[model samples]
Every structure is written in structure tokens, then in C-alpha cells.
Target chain A: MSSKITWPVPDPAAPPEAHPALVSAALSAARAYGEARAEHTRGELAESSRTGADGTATMRVDELVEGAIADTARRHRVNLLSEEVGFVDNASALTMVVDPVDGSNNAASGVPLSCFAGVMVEDGVPTEALTCWLDTGRCWHAIVGEDTAYRTSGRTELDGAALGLLRPHPEIGRSWWHLAERAERVRVLGTTCLEAALVAEGSFDAFVDPGNDAHRIVDLAAALVMVPAAGGVVRDVFDRPLEIDTDLTRRWSGVVAATPELAERIIETVRG
Target chain B: MSSKITWPVPDPAAPPEAHPALVSAALSAARAYGEARAEHTRGELAESSRTGADGTATMRVDELVEGAIADTARRHRVNLLSEEVGFVDNASALTMVVDPVDGSNNAASGVPLSCFAGVMVEDGVPTEALTCWLDTGRCWHAIVGEDTAYRTSGRTELDGAALGLLRPHPEIGRSWWHLAERAERVRVLGTTCLEAALVAEGSFDAFVDPGNDAHRIVDLAAALVMVPAAGGVVRDVFDRPLEIDTDLTRRWSGVVAATPELAERIIETVRG
Candidate 1:
């Protein structure tokens, strides 16, 4: 007996500098999220994963948003590699890698902190990225090897620096406490893509997954391009190389930080 | 070389069903916050507590918003009790208690999760309350003993419930881990009032302070009236009576839940 989250989703204010395909994809994702909110209650959206009458899995909000992005890819005539759909071939060297809804649980649960994260990869190299805050319609765009409109906090230490983290993994609870104790401030925003955007924009000094190994390629693709463009660095806690891959099964503990020194510090602490 | 958080603060969408004073105060807070964002950079706003050349503490984003709220109280001719500015007497029986900006750090940091929370009290009884998420302009309003438009999730167990929490305090970190481990999902959104509103509306199963005793009267003031109207209960972990009080020095560990049984379960788990 609950109502749906009724907040209106505004249009994406994508920067004029962003790629046309990325901008179009973000708009499509926003529309799909809005439509879902309008038609379904929070409970209904949360229950979209049940078996259908035909014994097939029902589409959740994530799949619905991904479907919209797929339509955008079709119009743009680019290949798509997304979390839910895996890969859709378009006979093009350029691929649009995306996490249609970054925090699918948050999106379905009516939390306003989800994101649309996409990167344009040319023959396995990410050339540009766009990440949009779906609720507020704010967008951040970045191209490889180019200066961005924003910069990181440039913080080099963990003490007195604001930190963002994924929720603790029960198996690694000590490491969670270790980093939380060292940081002067900590936030767990429940969305890795949005938290990474905050780090790129200097709102947060760093965002990390403390030994969780919970992020897929779709989760870190956009941050890999955007954070470095803004003078920050995105790394895996285990020192694994981050690249655009079509393997949806790969996972990493992504760390998006204001500076390389701080990223190393976080990795070391979590590992210790 | 970081930029200010440039997101616009929309006008509060205060429900027509609320007391005029609460709505007016929320509007004033939003306006003041917007003005501060337009006029100052994030680093400058973050350093607002410095002693000025005139030997006075500088006006912070928090103070600016509170000043505007005070002006609204003046216009309404009601007594005001707030966090930053302790209390203002208007020779009237009615008082407006507010946390001018609930997530002050989140506000100045441009995290887009801060809120304006206000409660209208008559002779120390909170008769009505209003909460506005400053980022999205969505609002929740409720009068004591009146049914609200939304209802809680009615979750009776913590095993699979989604939970929101305040950041961890080092001294009491075990309690934080205890609750986080038991919950099926956890989020630390860094804003108590907004998180409480999520619990009230069934977006989150519960929001708790985890024995930190970090909640001031202004933080939980709006939740006391709003959640109960929406079929939830807001309580203190230590079982302290919550009421309208002018003493800003007092604190409580707040537990806001969808049902009475769930509230008790959380309190017992945290206390253990």
C-alpha cells in the first residue's frame, strides 16, 4: 500500500560539447525512467523481476531503460554493449558502452541518485564519455586527452578529505571500518557512476569500493574516460587494468579518486 | 582550480495541504541557498567559517539560509527555534522549529541531497510539518493526526529490508556494522531529514542513526510529525521522549521505521 515516487524528471542539460550520440542516449534513458515512474508504483517496479506467465523473466526498470538506449543506438547506427543486453551488433567499429541505469535498485526504489553512464569506444578505445544525473538532469561530458570544464579537489591525503564508498561487504567489514576511520568524512551514495561523477566534479575527494569487487565494466567505463579528463584517476583496487570490454562477467573494485596518491592510499588501506 | 557546484536549487514544491508558515520558511531557505551558490565558489563556501578582515566569522551557506528563514519567521510573526540561530521570540504561542539546511556539508559541497525541514508548533506541540528536498523541489507535508498521501513499506523484518543510515562514528562503529550486516541492503546518504522522508514515503524501509546520538531536535523534528501520519514511527534508540525543546545542546539517536514492530526491532538490534 505505497505510492510511486512522483518527482518529475527534467530534460538532460547535456553540454554542447558532448557527442551527439551520447546526448541522445541520455535523453532516451531519462524518458524511460520517467515513464516507468508514471505507470508503476514503487512496489510494482521493485517486483518486475518475477517470472512471467510464459516462464520467462520479466523486465525490470534496468531492462526497460536499456531498451530505450538500444533504440537510440539503432538510430545512431552504433554498436551497443550494455550490462543488461550484453552486446548488440550494428556492424560498426564504434560502440556505445553503457550502464543504462547505474543504480538499478536505487532507481526502482525511488531514490533520486541513479545515473545514465555511457562512453563512446572506437575500436576498443574510449574516445569520450557522458554521465547524467537522471533525477536532476545535470550532465558531465568529457573527451579523452582534452581539458574538461571541471577539475578534481586535487586532494592528496585521506585525512580531512571527503570520501565516498560503496556499502560494506560483510566479508570485508574490517577493511570498511579501516578506511572509514581514516577519512575525515565519508558518504555512501549507493550509485557508483553518480559518485564517480561527484569525484570528477570535485564534490567528493574520492569514491571507492572497499574490497567488494562489485563493479562491472559497465560501471567503470564512463569513469575511466571522465575522471582522468578532469585531472583525477580511476583505478581498480587490485591494480587490474580498466578497459572497455564486452565481457559482462568481469568485475573490479573501482576507485575513482581526486589524485593518484590518494587512490594508492585507499587501495593500500583496503588491502591491509 | 575547482568550480562551485552550479546546479540550480528549484523552488520548494510544498504541498497545499501544509501550514503556510512551514511552506514559507522552506521557500526562503531555498532562495537563500540558491543565492549563496550563485555568488560563491565551492572552496570559498567551504571556507566560510574563517575570521574576516573585520574580525567576525564569515556568513556561511548555512547561515545565509538560516537568515532568510528568520526573515520568514518575522513576516509570519511566529517564534522560531532553529539550529544555527538558537531561538527567536515573537510573543506568539506558535513557533516554527527548523533545520534551515539539514545537510549543511552536503549543501556547501554541492552534493544535491540537502533539505529544508520545518515544523509548526503550537505551545510546544508540533501540529504540522513540511520537508522539501532542495535539489529536486519535491516536498512532503503532513499535519498531526491527519492521513498523508503516502504510506510506509510496512516491512516487519530487517533481514531483507532496505536501510538508510548516518555515517559511522568511530567509537560506536560496531553498532553500525551490526545493523549493516543484518540488512539485505544499506545506504548512507549523508542527509538525515531527506532519508527520514524516504522512510515515511516507503521509498526506504527504514532510516537510523545507529547509536551515534548525532540527531538534534531540528534534524528529527519534521520526521516526528510526518512519519507518524504516513503509518510509521520515529523514535530514539535510547527511548528518550521526543518533543519540542529550545535546547540546541541536546541530541538523540533517531530510529525512523515503517511500523512499530520494525522500529522496536531496529532499536533492539542497535542497542545490542
Candidate 2:
């Protein structure tokens, strides 16, 4: 596939809003990239031979998407913070945090549950966020100073709550098991951004990353804007604010819940 | 929404095999029904006012899909066995096991992870199966006497395997926790048929339903054909054959794994 793919450019007739235009560019780039590579067989896409800047093995499709997203970000004149390439300074105050493809394994294996996420941060605060499902072209967005379109389910209790968890590894196994015991349902869908979007839209009561710092800044930036806009709370496991530097090296464990009450209950239970 | 929605009929020029045509009819009906109800607001679809034949609260979308499926099965001359509206004998030797909407809660809440599943059984043995993802019109099918289109990942060990589980409830909590401890990853995506299909297509290594007889015949019938065709194994927790009566009153706890070795290990670990 050609590195330069054609996508719908932002309309000049629209109002001159930097954040919305940045989000539109990201969405168009992701959709175009996904369509270009969707025809590859699973075996072809699952080949992982290179190490990404995030310290994980990168698949062929991941690199392709990262390149596409980087081109789009540069065209939009936004600084880039991404998983594969880390932080790329464009000498601009507006930084677009991007996970070119979250749940790369799912995408390579044709699971249809992965997504692309971009959050435009201005002056160390996320002002706009957009996440698009790679398989379906469905997009969700939230802006800081606008009316929220989606809200949480307002389910405050742990019992009978629908929840999503990051996959369990040794470091976080016990914590994941504890949370699983308390949650009415636990889904580890393998995509952090999409799971967070599900919580923001009330489809899931909460999404928790147990104890391991498994998530990076690129993964949580979109959720940080979306959950708050949806009347939900996103916080670390210790109940601290989920703040992080715009770098891939740092990791955090946190919960995105439909309500503050539910977030608190999750913290207490998981800590125990 | 009108009950008489128009869907694309199967082409008459296609082969007239009973099983393939039956699957085609089911796919067309499900797509049509999903499109008809896709425009409803989440709140509207989430309204559950009546009890279903399975003793759960029924959503409006479930009723709509079930009616459409029933109509299709009648036109195809296959006897119906479904979760909602129970068994409707059409006096035919072939039985179509249908879960009109497998992940009803996800569908109602706009989660985009739900699916429609149907299995054609002859003399208590599943001969053909079809699963259609409602959100995306992707479909997977298998025939007993034909070449299978999908295959498993061939991961024989559990250490780094991608696993899926049914949500933990009181009756099955201990088994679920045990399995969670042993597996590398666990996802409770809330749709049994789709998860099984994921395993069949090499996305997940295995899928387990711990206990409490959480699944009905309508859910596993499709997986029965698909998993085996994909060179995977599906068996009960006690290592018995996964055969069951064609009625909805009975339930089973089972494991669908990419390999026989993994399936056996899961049974031993969860049973302990």
C-alpha cells in the first residue's frame, strides 16, 4: 500500500476550531489506514519482527498504522505522542496522543474489537478526544467545553456491575482475580481505549487496570477526556488523579467508572 | 419499527442444499432485523417489560429478532428451538437452534459486541452452524461434511494463551477464579457464540464456561460444529461428551479449546 493515502480533509467552511479539526484528521487517517490493510490475511498481519519505542514487539500492521497516523499529525501541525514512536515534538503546544492501533493482536487475528484513539491536549490538559473502531468506522468524541453526548449508567454498586479488565499477567494476577470476584461480569477485551469508551457510554459500568502499570499515556489520554465528559471518573488505583507525562515510558494503573461512588468502591475492594 | 421489514432474499440460482439455504435465510433475517431496530435509542432498546421463555427479562430488540427468526425458520421449513418463545415444532426432522440475540444487553446498550447464532441439528447432532455478528455483517459458518473455513491458533499451553470466560456468578465463582489464575488472559465479552467463533478462527486460544449451567442449547449448538471443524475440542467440564437434549430446560458447563491438550488441562484445573 502507498504511504500517502487519500482521506477526507477537514472542510474549510466549518468554524476554525483547532481541536475538532485535529480529531477529524486523526479519524480520517485511522479509517483510511485500516481500510488499506484490512485485506491482509491474519498470518501476514501477525508478523512481529521489530521492537517498538513502547518496548513491545511491533507487528507489521502496527507500523503501517503508526506511519499513517504520524503523517496525519504532521499535516495537522500537532505534536505527536504515540506508543510506537514515543514523543515527537513539533514545537507546538497542541499535542495529539495517539495509539495508532490498540489491541494489535486482536486486529491481526481478525477479532474486530480493536480501535484507534487520539486525544488533543492543550497546555497539559486534554481538551478533545476521538476514538474510532477500526472494524466498523464508528467514532466517539468528547470536547471539554461542549455539551456531553454520552453519560455513564449510574450503577454505583459492584455486585451485578458489568466491568472490563486489562488482561492478567503475573504482576497483576491477584488483583485481577480479586476484582473479578467482585464484579458481576468481567471482560478483558484487549483494547484499553475501546473499553474506556464503553464505560463512558454506559455499556459497561467500569473498566479497571488492576495493579500493574500496564497502560501508557497514549492509551488513557482519550479516556481522560471522554469519561469526564460522560459524567464518569478516571483515577489511579490509589484514588489519586490519573495524571501522567506525555511519554511512552511511564505506565499507570487506573479505573474508569460510570460514577464516583462506583470508582471508590472499586478502589477499596481491589486494595483489600 | 414495523414488523414486516424487507430483507434481501437468498438467490434462487444458488445450490439448493437444505443446510446452506437454511443458514442463508437466517443470515438475511438477522441482518434485516438488526437494521430495522438499529435506529432505536439505547434507552428504548434497554426497556425490558416482559419475561421471556428463558425466565429472563426480555428486551424489545430480542422480541423483534426472535419474531423475524421464527418467520425465517418457518419459511425454510426447519423446526425451531430458541431461548425466547421456546420450542416451536414445525414437524420437520431438522431442528434449527436459535439465539435471536446472543448478547442482548450489549445490543440494547449499544456495545456493538452482540451476534445472532443458529445451528441446524439432524437426529440430535449438529450438522451445520451459522453465526452473524449484528454490529458488523460478518458471518462464520461450518458444515459437517465440508471443508472448514477457519482454524484454531494451535496454542497447546496456557502460560501465554489468550483465554475467554463466561462472567462469574455465585454458582460458578470458584471455578472461574481457578481458571483465571491459570490462564494468561481472560475476557468475558458477554457473547458466548462470538467468543467461541473467536477461538475457532485463532483469535482466542480457548473459551470456558465454568459452571452453574450458565449456557443453554441455543448458545452452544453453533460452536459444537464450528469448534470441531476448526480442529478444536468442545466438551463438558466432567470430560463427558457435550451432547444434550434439544430442549431449553437443560444447561451445561463446557470448554472450547484450540487443542485437546488445552481442553483437558482446563477441565482438570477448573474441576479441582
Top candidate on lDDT is 1
Per residue, candidate 2 scores C-alpha lDDT tens digits across A1-272 of 11111112221121234366455555655654556455555666768888787888888778777887787777777788888788788788888888888888777666667788888888788888888776666667788877565778888898777788887665766777778777766777889999998888788889998877777777888888899888898888865556647546767787889999998888887787
Per-residue lDDT of A251 in model 1: 83
Judged by whole-model lDDT over C-alpha atoms, candidate 2 comes out at 0.74
For residues B1-272, could you state the per-residue lDDT of candidate 2 as single tens digits? 11111112221121235366455655655655556455666657667788877767888778877887788878878888888788888888888888888888777766677778888887677888888777666677788867675678887887666788887665776777777777766677889889998888887889988866777777888889889898898888865556646556667787889999988888887888
Give per-model CA RMSD.
3.3, 5.5
Q: Which lDDT values do the candidates have, in the order given? A: 0.87, 0.74
TM-score of chain B, per candidate?
Answer: 0.95, 0.86
Clashes of 2: 0
Model 1's CAPRI class? medium
Minimum summed lDDT over a 10-residue window in model 1 chain A is located at: A50-59
**How much is A81 displaced in model 2, in angstroms?**
0.8
Please name the candidate that would achieve the greatest DockQ relative to the true structure: 1
Model 2 chain B worst lDDT window (10 residues) = B1-10
Cα deviation at B197, candidate 2, in Å, is 1.0
